[model samples]
Target chain A: MENLRLLFDAPILTVQLLLDGILIGAIFALAAYGMMLVWGVLNIINVAQGELVMLGGYVAFFLFKAGINPLFGVPVAAALLFVVGWLLYRVVIFRIVDKDLFISILATFGLSILIQQLAKVAFSPDVRTPQAGFGTISMFGGAVTVTWIKIISFAAALTTGGVLVWFLRGTRMGQAIRATAQNARAARVMGIDTDRVYAWTFGVNAAICGASGALVAMTYLVDPYIGLPYTIRSFMIVIVAGLGNISAVLATAIGLGAAENISAFLFGAEYQIAFVYGLLVVILISRRIVLARQRRYLA
Target chain B: MSTATGKMALALASAALLFLYGPTGATAQTEGDTINLGAAVSLTGKYSVNGKNTKDGYDLAIKRLNEMGGVKVGGKSYKLKIVYYDDESTPARGAQLAERLINQDGVKFLLGAYSSGLTKAIAPITEKYKVPHVEGNGAARELFTEGYKYLFGVLSTSDYYLRDAVNMAAEVAKENGRDPKSMKIAMAFENDPFSLDVRAGILEAAKKHGMKVLVDDKLPPEINDMAATLTKVKAVKPDLLLVSGHEKGATLLVRQTSEMKIDVPIVATTHCDSAKIAETMGKQAEGILCASQWDRTLAYKDKWFGSADDYAKTFQKEFNYPAPYQAAESTASVLVFADAFQRAGSLDPAKVRDAIAKTDVMTFYGPIKFDETGKNTKKPMVLYQVQGGDYKVVFPSKWAETKIKYPRKLPTN
Candidate 1:
């Protein structure tokens, strides 16, 4: 009650919370986009989505340690993760592609644990942040503080979203992927080489997550265990936006981010995660009720 | 041919039975001339870093003790060895591992885990089994209040960790001619046992000094950002900001406070050394007060590690990192165990427990004197201010190495 009144008393804090939320939401959107891509195209919910992001962050961290500016790590991390995604598809994802959704989920869940353990062994379970050296930009007479790295992350997320949209709409491979997502057997009959499309789609999703991970490493910090929260957040965002709805994903991500920050400010930081999971429960229940009213249970 | 096959099957079944039940049934707390201590530490989870430090502390002590002719018990020299199991930093796993260590491995003595939560989980099992458990890491006052006779600690309870910081803030406020009662505090503590205890301690101090609490937030364990809390701090403009969420909280608080340009007069937290804030964050970490159980510069000494500085040097040579207080206190825990073993002159858990309860010794970390509730009563928590890229003790006047820089200057980007 007191916190709510304080918000009204000094409205500038709302601006700070919203700005921080929106910036953080941008990175969340990027990760969610990758999740949506893989879920839509491959029909496999990649539980390992966060681990890929974690690996990308490690890539950026290592690059930073190697004396390279981490800002350049976005592209390098994306490129490297593309190969990792391709290899993962060829080795394990291929078998689960035609399997049950539950099977895919279990497989990816195991893969997530494996990746986290491997990263722990490889990188050491230290909370690491790459110094981006991009200082803060004071706004509204220093009432609101914004980090330059966060602004860059927001821009990078938008650019990546734009490039992803263009790739799907303008490129031939993108069309093949879209077609494969729609009707795999039909696309295969039309000479789409559906397997290659699946591989590329999965790779592209991972590359997107990788790019976002580099942004995360620069803006915040990363550790092996940090991946699960990202995975859960992206999952929530994707489910809310519905798979493959890029714009909705972006909007929902930002909204969720702002809501999280405002809720944390009002309810205390302990409720921040509770607010997220509570929102997820509410969304899921409301969707179910709406579907029931239509006399159709959700599949 | 059938008789021969049946005889071979019988032989195989007998061998398998022996393999399954032999070692467990015969296992003893002491094997020949060696005393076994069991520890379930976090080797693969969030607390892994501190867990590793705890393990290193135990290992170094055991190695040194064995080198110095081991513990003389019952007119016999016995080597000390620890059987370790990874608890994965979960309470359930810790409890299960504690059971396995006692029931299966037959470990009569137990050492502490990294965090208060893990120790809380394992303590009951030790108490039930009547095993003498001595720990240095678990400092939550709640642990001592449970009145577990077998549980002995070598470090001060969690509340003491930041009590001195609050007192110092009040003192500074009074010295500056400001009404200490008018000062406001903002606290952001992790929603865990240890940090919450620290919060309770600060709140008690604030209430006693008649200071107002502007903002009290509980940081989630996996928290990576503090924008909401900081935003509140900015709006309320509190005189002091107290944060405690272990290493992650320390790192984030130092990093974000600078980025946000928060101008709180005093910023104090726990786990700055464990987080390596002075070294990693450097200028941004300056002027932040840190609560620590021990520092290498303290003029504490014992037979095994000599002075605190000597123990730190030895630890660095072995582990290749400066010994944080987590490791230092852990080493102290082992020293307490060794002392108990010598005094008891036996491996009986009851005798050892009594010996531990009567412990009043000094080691490289600090003096270890357990009160009635199994918490160390002698050790005083030290406050370190990060000054010029180093941690300088600035509190508890008798042990103070330097004066505190008041109204901390935030680094200009």
Candidate 2:
């Protein structure tokens, strides 16, 4: 009977834990969705994606400091980063995409280091945050506390995601991009300028990444080095979602969040992030095993 | 095969092999030969502030030693040259640098590393190479327990720093008529071995004072969202908060604490040496207490630290930041290495190890003597509180040059 009582009590903590996980998971999805898009179409992993986000954050921060409203700075930062991304793709990434896979990886990693070091040299490693607009809103008899800034930013991300999904599904440029991704040679033969599509796709990814960073800055402080961890977390989410599954991205994020919370509650906060990495290792191992078995069956 | 001539030749060949690969083969340096020391300081990462300061301290010591005509041994003075590599506070990179230092650089003495994880990672390479490692900044107890004969730590552990800070906090709480026993304490530490050792100290001290730890949290090394952690800390309503981490982590925590209006006094370990923390937190960091082995502002009239103030002053004048806690540690390490090499009267690796094992010298930090476990004895920690945005000695009043601020909150003019 005592054990039953304990079990009943566990659900309340579990629900809270899950809720915390899902909230953080939502943030991860927003952060990594751009990477998935860039990877799926361009066939080159954008290692500097996190740095682009950081650039966006700094832009928003400076704009806010210069007397612009933070909410208004998001789109402006996104647009600025879009142009920068477009230029970067034209100058750097596009030149290296056709190179060997290892070379491309090295180029992007080098680009990441260059961007990070540039940021370090230009803007010291001090933490920055866009000025806050609205405060927290209480929900569910005060059991849940949601910040207005978080809600607005997260809602904006969802809308942007929906708009992207719609554009890809319903627009001419989107169709061309999809066609290029599915069969580049076929699309090129049918009069699609595949190189132009790559540029546009890469620019769009950078713009979205910027928006995510700006939104992140509104709710959280960002230091120059936050990009590396963002990259790791984004890769963790994308890999765990089993690749090419958009909806599973959210599910993976939520799973990670819940896992982190449970680990914190049971094992203590020191092991919470460690718990997330452990789950990532498990997921990666399982995927490898599944792939090996499938390859054996095919053989 | 068993012929007498064959057996004699085989025995001779085995003897040659032993001479090349055995313990005696750990790079036999002659009395007149120069001893190479490898330094893998943080140099450029988050701990760069302290790492650079430590490097400066190291360079200054090495320069002074060389100017004194080097270590005199066997009727000759053989100058020491340090082959310094920047590990940038990454443990994996530190390990790689350690391997390079041992295998490629052929260094028999290692003298720099600030982070505990970095030191722990590089310690094994020293053991494998059969060279003595004189740790400068790291303070994890686990490093001492590894049973490696060649590893010697010069600084007090994170455990000492945290316990001293907490004990001081407890003293303040008791004096202010707050029930020290019932006072809620929150432990927020970085998720690393150094912080873990400090956390252990906090728990131990809290138990001693009968204080209840209401909240405990660990932030990742790359965490920037200390807002949530601060919120959790506030919810606990702790009378005291113990923070164990390095410069960046310390700065973020104090800043977030101010934003959340969590007025609970902070008790930090030796991680408070970074100038960035004071600059970032500004007014918010005032009154936060920390325990350390040495603060640059502290001057003992007759001590070696006082004598080294000119060296520390140069660093402060150049960088516009106070000298780091590890500066004295690194400086002491150079002195220890010089002393050992001089005592050994030879630069031979085994002889140097023996000399270091038998080291008994005074340094900037204190009287340095290594136990059988290669842990330094006579190393003591002092408590300091940030008063008027400057860290001032407050505890061990015998050594306290400034008046102690006994209660919480910064003293008003």
Candidate 3:
């Protein structure tokens, strides 16, 4: 009650919360975009989405250590992760691509653990941040503060989303991917090498995660186990946005981020995660209810 | 052919039996010239960093003790050796490993796991088995409240971690000519056994001083951001901001507080050294007060490690990193076991348990005197302020390296 009154009394805090939420949400949306693509095209949940992001952050971290600016590490990480995703698709993900959803979930979950453990061994379990040196921007006489790295992340997310839309609409490979997503068998019959398409789709998804992860490393600290939360957040955002809706995924991710921030402010940080999972439950139940009503109407 | 085959099979059967029972027999509390201690520490997973520290502390103590001709028991010298199993940082695994160490390996004496949660899980098993367990890492107050006679902790309870910070804030408030009762405290603690216990301690201290708790937020274990909580801090403008969430909590609190520039009069936290904030975050970590179990500069000396500074130096040379309090207290736990072994003059667990109960010793870590509840009553938690890229002790005037930097000036970068 006191916190709610404080929000009303000092509304600038609301702006700060929302701005932070939106900036963070943009990265969440970027991860979700990759998840949405893999879910739609490859029919795999890609539970290792967060691991890819974690690996991407490590890439930027190493680059920073090597005396390269982490800002340039964004594209480099994406490119490297693209190859990693392609190899992973060939080695393991390909076997589960055509399997049941449950099988894919279990397989990818195992992959997530494998990647996390390997990263732990390779990088050690230390919370690390690649210093972007972007500094902070104060607004309204320092009443609201925004980190420059976060703004860069926000801009990167937007640009990636725009580029993703253009790629899917303009390129011939994009049309082939769309066709495969619509009907793999039909696309295969039309001489569209659907196997390559699936591999590319998975690779592209990982690249997106890599880019988001670089931004995340610059914005917040990254650790080996930090990937699971990003996976959960991306999964939630994809569910709320639905499959194949790029704009909706972006908007819902931002909205979820804002709602999480506001709810944390009102309910205390202890309930922040509880609130997220609770909202997931509510969204799922309401959707089921609406579907049930439609079935009744049909009957 | 039947006679020769039967003879060979009989010999092989006897050999297999010997192979199985030989190792179990050797794993007894005392083997020949070595005293074996069993420990289940985190070698992997979330607590691995601290787990490694605990293991190193134990190893360093064992190495030093062995070099000094080991512990003299019953008119003979016995070297110390530890049988270790990786707990994987899970409470269930820790409990299971404790049972395995006791039942299967026949390890009579046990050392502790890393965190309080794992310790809490293993404590019941040790109590059930009548094994003497001495630990340095697990510091939750609830562990002491459980009435486990066999579980002796060398470190102060978790609640004491941030309590001194709260008291210091109150003192600062009074010094500034403001009513201490009018002060508001905002706390963000990780929702874990250890951190919540720290929160409880801070709350008690705040209540005793008649301070209002404006924001008591429980951060999720997987939290990467606390912007929402910080936003509330901005609005409420609490007199003091207290955060306790282990390494991640300390790191995030320092980073976000600087990024958001949420300037409260006092900002205090735990795990600043473990998180390496002074070294990594540098200018941003300046003026932030951190609660610690032990600091290298303390005037504590012992026969084994000489002084606290000497122990830290040896540890850094061995481990390639500065020894956090986790490692210090862990080393102290090993020292406690060695002392008990020497005093009891026996290899029996019950005798060692009794000796450990009557422990009144001073070491490089601190004077460790456990009360009836297995809680160390002699040690006081210290507070450190990050000054010019180093942790300088600024509280508990006896060991003060420097005076407290008042009101924590925000870096003008």
Interface RMSD for model 1 amounts to 0.8
Could you give candidate 1's fraction of true interface contacts?
0.66
Residue-level lDDT of model 2, residues A1-299, one tens digit each, is 33224325544434444555566566667667778777778777777878887887888788877878777767887798889888988999898766776776788889889989999889887666565556555444433455566667657767877878887889999999899889888999999999999888888888887887887776666667778766777778887775566677767766776666556655656566677788888878988999999999999
User: In model 1, which runs have C-alpha deviations exceeding 4 angstroms?
Assistant: A280-299, B1-134, B301-306, B311-327, B330-363
So what's the TM-score on candidate 2?
Answer: 0.67
Docking class for model 3 is medium
Correct interface contacts retained, every candidate: 0.66, 0.20, 0.80
Residue A283 C-alpha lDDT in model 2: 78
Clash number for each model: 0, 0, 0
Positional deviation of B365 in candidate 3, in angstroms? 2.1
In model 2, the Cα lDDT at residue B210 comes to 92
**Can you tell me the CAPRI class of model 1?**
medium
What TM-score does each of the candidates earn?
0.83, 0.67, 0.84
DockQ of each model vs. true complex? 0.55, 0.15, 0.60
